[model samples]
Target: MKLMKDEIETRRTFAIISHPDAGKTTLTEKLLLFGGAIREAGTVKGRKNSKHAMSDWMEIEKQRGISVTSSVLEFQYDGYHVNILDTPGHEDFSEDTYRTLTAADSATMLIDAAKGVEAQTKKLFKVCKMRGIPIFTFMNKLDRQGRDPFELMEELENLLGIRSYPVGWPIGMGQSFKAVYDRHHKKLELYNPDNPKDIDIISLSGPDDPKLDEVINDEGLVAQFREELELLDVAGDDFDVDLIARGELTPIFFGSAISSFGVQTFLQHFLSLSPAPTVRESTIGPIDPKTREAFSGFIFKVQANMNAKHRDRVAFLRITSGRFKRGMSVKHVRTNKPLKLSQPTQFLAQNRSIVEEACAGDIIGLFDPGTFRIGDTLVEGEAFEFDEMPHFSPEHFAAITVKEALKHKSYEKGLQQLTEEGAIQLFRTYNKYVEQQIVGVVGVLQFEVLEHRLKGEYNVDIQLERQPFSFARWIDGPSKALATLKEKQRNLVTDREGRLVALFENEFQMRTAQDKYPELTFYENSFYKKSII
Candidate 1:
């Protein structure tokens, strides 16, 4: 089957990546406003009277003023069905951000004018580069005094190994910020902070339009702006669509996310330039987005306790091809069984509505009753699977147990749900009779989140005892070798999936074990091998 060209061209999906405090959430709110998805834009930092951002729906995010989990939002703008993946900017949750990127067709890189490119941005950019996804740069917070435009462009090239092509140029900085000069259209867009949504567009016959002089009363500023524009035209990289599509060059736009300046222009140009959903790689081969074959998609994220009142879980899926309808039955590629998807929902942050139908490039959530996991594939025809998603190795370890015997059931249930959600990894001692559990995480903040959720959502408290181990490896070998190794190693355990593992205090300890047990093999990630059904 083949999809109509018009239907395929109307869809766009991308993710936003940025560093902490870089106004990523603010940009998301403003984009939603332009799309008519929301009537009033909400601040990321919730106020007594103002609503919080639609994308940061978690209670923990509202309380902490930072996104801790990835959120998928879909809306309509300019006759395009846009799917936005808003990722966590905090370095503590880089794993979540990495997983979210796997589902995006392209990425928007947000850089603060004050801070050129922070540590987290570099890490995120490396992932995008590795995937060879096209990236668009938005220099945010131009209303504040920041680095020179030339310097910022130079930094992007020097650090990220990518060329920058300025699609628009700023007139001035901070309080003196007046307007942006559109290089492509050769026009000036006058800024109005008091009414940022109302932009006054003026055509520029040339740099010496008398109307420009009237709008820019500051003679000195106008002269300086003209000189900069001339310099940029002469020295900047030419706007090459081929280079941008290849991820070799990024078009730059300057704006203030809070005041909505330059946001609408950026949105319009982005929609016209960005690519629609392309091809996805699977075990069978590459799956084309334009194909109208039986529906197929994979789960990249599994969230539990989305509705705390109901204690529900939702698995987020990105449709790769064909159309999806409510009450459709799809084969679970891993389990080799058919599942009737009865309640597929679309997200407006935490507020969700049932989706009657969706198509390729769209993201929708399916209700999961402990039957789904990240990386599970749903298909309607012959069985096939996508490439396995990366499972990050945990760097921190801890021993944990419930504080009270009476709360053991609730504690166990909470632990199982959270682990299944990929918040943390759970392991047990090889001695099956032992009741204590060991946990591993990429960061220390996960421990705090686990404690908060256990007490707040499950009515159970936990006691965490820090462990000296800094690394863990899953063991693979014969039963006799495993027994002999466990007998010699003091730190040996088994994961919830019943896989044998060993904990090491540091790199040296892990090396010693590898040398002593030459017959055994070790795996840093449990999902290293692909087992297709």
Candidate 2:
């Protein structure tokens, strides 16, 4: 077996983002297929019950055709190691997407060619911008009926605030879509199932080429195309045509992913153009929970494995910097918990390989930290602790009550376990009666998963109640009496200009310690202020 490099390594990691069903998972599967990870491609809708798609892990995801939790997959192409973070596209899982993005250097923003840029796509792109991550846009579903690619390009620029040049151009649209003209190669590559081993790139100005004839269909487009060709002819310039191809114009690729058409070309494009880990900038910090100067890595994901007889936990890690080795003790940032590293494993889907140590900027796995919690940073000493990635509080919340009266007591334990694994957040309301609420971004789809997992994994059945409007305000005084009286009482509210004026609640608030009174908290309360997330 060939050993990896001794001088650490070079790699490229990217989180794939898209609105739901824009084909992010399918695109990921195609990339993996081309990289020789799987023997065959699995469809989102399966023919047989036995064949499971690699990207969809949870039973709920498989049944619903959506991604809930993010999954990591690795493949080597052209001597470059690529780590792919496949994330959920639904708005409910947006926080998960953002947290996962922190571990990546760049992102591939996928949009449906038919629908153009959707709401979630724009939101995720802004997040990438905020994190200073470069983005590569993939206009997918070209085979579906849609507007012109040019219009889509305009939308991308206008909405996402990014300059997108096509890397490939589609030969046709809808059912007629057959080939992708490579802008870089200056040739049209036709997809051939029988010739999967070698893809043939054909020249454009050749004899009676059937592919070229098939591509130049629309009369208006044909006229413009010939005009461009003639302009190049008059310039006394030997137009390589490839130069036009090399520029950042969108390279449209055609073919159906279901048929495995043009999939190989996409893989070729990724291996050729996608930036690897070595090229990306690295951020280093400490592992200690008490301080920020030490080295600590954050575990962004944890999966509970209670499949049949196997009971184990899979921990996903993004090492900010420094080094972590097996048997070394590290502090868990969230709860000030200390953990002894057992074995560090490099995970690829379900398969894992043991590694002696993981260094800065590396995304790897840890073998069962028994009591692992998501968002906990593993640091060497007290000084290396850093804030967890900023996860948006769940927008839509629901009150879940036990369906079976007898199971109500056990539900909290099971639900708590789920939340501890970072599946969701459980909030205990300080009302007269204890009301445990599951707060999270609610995509209609993930709620299904939440209910399904509750039943399947925990064997608990619960009812859900969609919540109503709620907001938090910083008060000048502290008292249940003050909190109660602040009704219709616009006392004082602060604005962006730092001017405090009348802010009203349902009533006026009372003062506990009039001296220390209302300090006022904004969107950030205790946690964000403490961790600086």
Candidate 3:
């Protein structure tokens, strides 16, 4: 009981978000390196003989050297149980990234030194801001020749509409990159990339210490470093924990993730300052982590065949209240059924170990035999659903065709499992399931992954014919009202659950259909928030 509350206080669940190639995976590996989760860090993109990143466990991810799906990684550091959600940096997989954000209490926004704020960075940051989560900014790739730190800070305020306070500022960047000066400690931590773990710190009287000149050797570089530090001291925003908690101000740290410089410093400060497991919103209202006694949680992600040999599905559940113990029977709120949570495991990417118990803010994977879903709430005492996750209006659609008609079993199995995992939505032209299957996704890259996975995993090769349609709307209200609108709308499809969807080729067509069928309610978002029960 008391131990549960203490454990909850020490939990910090967060997600790392950034644009493609901004070093999100590299930063994630470095954090794991500091946490002692892995023996040595691996590169995001490696040679044929070299090892790929641990977080990117998928074969396609290994081949492309990019994270197209979010993976959960947990580790312990300095009395804190940290759960790191490594999300996809590619915009094509932004929908999966967005859903993962719902489970996180805070976010770590990684920014490239050269490209200040990118299109995908802006998009993910907007989602964080919308969720009102505290964001910690890390200016990565300082080992490479990049933009001025001051310019990057200004761009953050001007473009992202957020202020920043640098806790550790870089002494130099690119090949001349030396180290990060700890502003709070008034110490210059020397960068020793040769043996990064053997860190050396010099306690300075101040930034103007003459001893620094001898250590740096470069007089001009020392002068510029002191000047920048002086300007930042006098004019920078004051460090405010309250503002950071409110997502208004971000505490920025400068370092190169690949070199493993300034990572431990960042991790230490982040744990002490970042928010822990907090109150969760539910249908019954706020569920406080400390006060609620009954074990309850919600499924934010369900992935299939994480362990290829097992052929199983794992549901990633974020415990909202109380503690979960292995083999406990709990109410599956969606189905109004009871379930024995016998096999609960914690993760280091695909590798897993059975966990005896887990508390709030902890993510545990339940061996789900196709019984769990995203946003399904499980509870011990009472039943209530968490707020529904968004089902974005698809911007792209394609008709799927299996290469071998004889392999219908494998093809059907692949399509059903993928759709169930929320990777993509399946739709048909009529009420019949056999009618041309149209798959809709938030981005185009998903189509590629879909094709790749079906062939790779299920032994079913597929060809996707692109559709002319751009958007889909779920129909509501009178069926008769859709009669006239359906005549004008050539493509009226039925979604997986048999909901009528009017596929529009353009916004003009959507507007025209709306004007024609004023009585019918057309919802752009296809949200099935309610359960069958």
Q: What stretches of model 3 exceed 4 Å from their correct place? A: 193-198, 431-434, 483-488, 528-533
Candidate 3 local lDDT, 1-533, one digit each (tens)? 46778889999999999999999999999999889999987787653667889899888898899998899999999989999999999999998999999999999999999899999999999999998899999999888899999999999999899999999988888878787888888888787757866778888888888888888888888989999988998999999999999899999998878877788889998998899887778889999999898999999888987888877889999998888999999999989999999999999998999999999999999998889888899999888988888568889999998888899899998898888888999999963445899999999999989998888788888889999999899988776776666666578898877778989899999999888788988897777334375
Order of quality (lDDT): 3, 1, 2
Candidate 1 global TM-score: 0.96
Candidate with more favorable, higher TM-score: 2 or 3:
3
- Winner on TM-score (1 vs 3): 3
Higher-TM-score candidate of 1 and 2: 1
lDDT of 2 by residue, 442-476 (tens): 35455666788878877889898866523223333
- For candidate 3, the 10 contiguous residues with the lowest summed lDDT are 524-533
Q: Considering TM-score, where higher is better, how would the candidates rank from best to worst?
A: 3, 1, 2
Question: Which candidate tops TM-score?
Answer: 3
RMSD of each: 2.0, 7.4, 1.7
Model 2, residue 289: distance off in Å is: 21
In model 1, pairs of residues that clash are: none
- How high is the lDDT of residue 445 in model 1? 83
- TM-score per prediction, in order, is 0.96, 0.76, 0.97
Native-vs-model 2 lDDT? Answer: 0.60
